[model samples]
Target: MPTPTPSPDELLVFTGSYTPDTGGNGAGLAAVRFAPKTGSLTDEPRVSPVPVSGASFLAAHPSLDVIYSTNESDTGAVSAVVRQDEEVLSPLGAPVSSGGANPCHLTVHPDGHWLLTANYGSDTMPGSVAVHRLDTDGRICELTDVAVHEGTGPVAGRQESSHAHQVLVTPDGRFVLATDLGADAVFTYRLDTGTGRLQRIAVNRTRPGSGPRHLAFAPDGAYAWSADELSSTLTCHRYDPDTGTLAEVSRVPATTVPDVANQPGGIVASPCGRFVWVTNRGADTVAAFRVTGTSLQPIGEVPSGGIWPRGLALVAGHLLVANQHSGTLAVLRVLPTGALSRPAPAAHVPSVVCTLAL
Candidate 1:
């Protein structure tokens, strides 16, 4: 077997089920020092706390001293936490509620001065995106603004109203993209860094039944990829950085799994922008794709080797998967050909799995 790239000194994981009502707090977040080059983990992994109701989505600040997570509640909130050390992370303070409901995803500004959240809720009440200012110490302050969305989807039962699932910022800090599952559209917002404001720029519809969930931009910033959970498809868009607009270039099936019930979960591009991967929870696999311009061609599917793979992260050159149902983090070696292999048994956690990073 070919030797693996050297692993980072430590890895930290955050699970979603930390709540006082559930007999816990951030205590479910765990950390371990690992040697990926040798495929070995620490004798005893260290665990930490991430304060939030449901750690559904996580984002690390570009500068790496802070992390943000969506609380994902019926009455939802977002928590900003400071990374104190290798095995320590504590909440900066109380989580700021998303000001709508069921807040699901979040992203930090490139300047690290603001954070945005997507609140996914029912139509009777509607959903919204909230913007907050982050101070130097990583504590969130200044509840500046909220943008409510309208319109319903084609699926009557599933799309009665707005359900904004993710909020993403362009690498240059010029724009923010919010994906609405209910509306099946990606809304662009022009960001004002000084005032921490979001101005609606454009709304691009995905496939009618697509139910856009999450998005990731290519490293080069030439294209953006959106994962449609309901339609099981991926759409590529040509991103205009100067204007902060998205133009759909192509649409392709997100997975080759024969099971039609499988739902797409996470969408992420390789740090190098050469490959894209999407998780299929019910199919228990990860779909790999090669990118050319704004088009994506499926490479293949690899068994995630666990149940309900909800999240994917890259740490020290290894692809780590948080298998929600299996309660274990599966580690895969990304081959040069863009393939992933069954992991050799290493770090394991029980109950729920959410994120893995170093």
Candidate 2:
């Protein structure tokens, strides 16, 4: 008997891009449909109805028809949009200040009560994480709390000040973790859901000059992994959900050519929690690894099918890469052995930095 082919899933993907004012030619948030069977994307993307600037990152509400994005500007801001249908998005309200400079990443609380932003400060500014309240309509209503971090790594130019690159809530939804590239640390906090305040809990330090960028937790929430942007390395840790403590287990290169100028962009663990993947920007590749009880064994690496892959998402058994410099989205089929095939170009969206599938 032969295996039956699975029917394709119709996926609505939203892409975030750098705007003209940010040194790129992006019109703003763009939408495209993806066909899983053919590994193809809609020929043209539908631009957002309203103008948005520096929408470098986006996050979808866990259970609502709404999307949130970081403005990624000197005066940071975050915006919300309501999904009118499968194809259209309507602005929910005016953009709200993110309470810091150059806000880069944002995420919605698992309970859908709060929105969080990680601001990557410039030379003159300090990095901070801000929280906002989400209204019944899924719109951002007001600022709730802001936690500012102070520290620096050993790196000379890149670690001059604190730069929080990403904020992630634990799978149990009890704690929030922020990655600071400039500080070489992952700061842990307990979120006060009622007040939106963050209580500092723990600080997990990585190797000096590692420049921890982003992290993904295991499906069971027992482990966590981080992609180091500066040293081009990956670090694994045992995560204690109850205490919000991350204990380091191991560190390994994100790419085979470690001496090269490879910068890891995004890191994700497989849905089954058996595999982990990281995107290498300078090398333009995706590295795969086998996860074994909080330890990592390098699997292999494959071409990203474009230049400067910055963000990646796993959708419907496929891996999608947002190639920032090449202005293209690439799709790779995830094999049964937990490896990714060479990607095929899907769509062209200029200066794309983030991909969110809903």
Candidate 3:
């Protein structure tokens, strides 16, 4: 008998979009089937599951059976959807309140016990981080706790109040870190697994106006990098897992274009921990860097192939960028040397803000 060849992995890509709130054209959650080998996506995505407003960020369950998204509306909420098949998703239940206003980012606990959200408050509202208990079926049950952050950064218009942008879990699953764009701080918390509660451990302050937005940790949990939205910089930090503390290592510009208005978006560390990539919205580029033990050496940058690149995902050696303003997803090849090739023509999506691949 002849030997059989294995089929290429079919990448199931999930995207969240900004709806009426952000002047977005999206109707709801969208799904696309991507072929990794060809770097191509289905001509037209099947946008379904739910017609939610402000489904801006998404997080997948560890079991890959459920998906959660932040409903970035005046009354913040998190919605859950069950994965019915390769190309189908259905709402699991009614969205539950995030315990704050304008929830922007979320992540599932590695242990599959909780879902965490960062609520980016408006000018009159205060920012907060909320934890929700997850039932055995991966559906969100109730808001277990909400950790309200206090403080403001130096930027008057943008930092007049706390704006928690993202919530991320440590690789070890013992702690949770939330980045506050308006506060210019990364607040750390100890996760009580048994209770699904968040206990404030430490607050790591960044440069006065850095406006830390999103973070990515090294594979081994030794180091971490934060993408500062207001400052348009990437700050490296030495991560102490046991103590849940982050010490600044270095801060560098995320874009090579000098004096250009830049807003850094997503930050992702390569699986092997050799490289870190950050998206520059104003410059419409993806900046690549070589990671060397808490130090970042700029490698180069490649065009995002669209406008306002807000999200990035590394899947099967390819870098996928979600350009929110242009409403397209750009696929770029990631070379072994940590450089990126020119991105493929944009794939259509309406106000795409985040990407998740499985």
Candidate 4:
């Protein structure tokens, strides 16, 4: 059922949450409007106050209208926004300091001159990836390099150390993947863009409890996709894009529901990269895969119109989902064979996890 109206190609979403001083109830940064022939998101949404406390995650600036976030707390920050027009988004200076602690994912370096972050380190600290140097007008011009990230796994109270969540940036920009939910690992780096430094190269392990949280790159850059989040699996890599390295091959079961209590919480890839979608968060569901020819073809799992589906975004051929603990904002309808239809809501966003379309 298409045509719910609104679409001159209308699409602009930047929602990221967990803001009421971090107990979450997000009212800090939000603004939705996507409508690709009504795939949904505009019944009016915009909780934005633009304060930036725990702005969970967002990144956009391939050529600058700018917008970057991840100010996740316990003392972590990073911001740079701009787009004060079709519904405001201000703030472009006054956020720095994210060299460590909870910065949960970020990326922007397709020559926009580096801004990567993925701190997630608390519980006595370990994970880190900082590096930020961007000023052609995109703001943020300091924090030049951190890179910590030791190790630990087997998942006790969530792997005990090195928790770096996500920080990918490899669509041929020459590698900088980070994901390390307490070290099930996936650390290839090498972005010394004249000194913002990263330079790790390759670690890529996966499988002993597999907490690897988010890392999806398959636009034809050969293949890569992981959302392992503490064993609610889905691995399948082989990518090498001129030696950034991944090579795991296959794993599956990102929530087909058997013993329940899953956790994948987000993984996306489909700009016709032949499909991949995952978001299991305790099995609230949203799975679907089919990268065939290099493995992965489970295409099954549904229901994620709400509840815990952290975030998954694929715009313009739908599949928006950001259901954090059921605070809505679903969309799902990308089935011309990639399969995923059966999500509906489109806005209710209370503590919505993350989504960025621009």
Q: Estimate each model's TM-score.
A: 0.89, 0.95, 0.95, 0.34
Q: Report the C-alpha displacement of residue 111, candidate 1, in angstroms.
A: 1.2
lDDT of 4 by residue, 1-358 (tens): 0112233768767788887798887775777787677676773754345767888888887877778888887688888888755565688878888888889889888889888989888887788989889999789888888989888898799887888888877888787888888888888998878988888987888778788888887877788888888778788888888888888877878877888888887888887788788888877889888888777888787988878888888887888888877677888888888888897666887888988876
lDDT of 4 at 47: 32
- For all candidates in order, the CA lDDT equals 0.74, 0.86, 0.87, 0.81
Q: Model 4 Cα displacement at 46 (Å)?
A: 17
Q: Highest lDDT among the candidates is held by which one?
A: 3
Off by over 4 Å in 1: 1-9, 13-28, 39-43, 350-353
Tell me how many clashing residue pairs each candidate has: 2, 0, 0, 3
Which residue window of length 10 is worst by lDDT in model 4?
Answer: 1-10
Q: After TM-score superposition, what is the CA distance of residue 14 in candidate 1 from its true location, in Å?
A: 4.4
State residue 28's C-alpha deviation in candidate 1, in Å.
4.7
Overall local distance difference test of candidate 4: 0.81
Candidate 3 clash pair list = none
- lDDT at residue 10 of model 3 (Cα atoms): 63
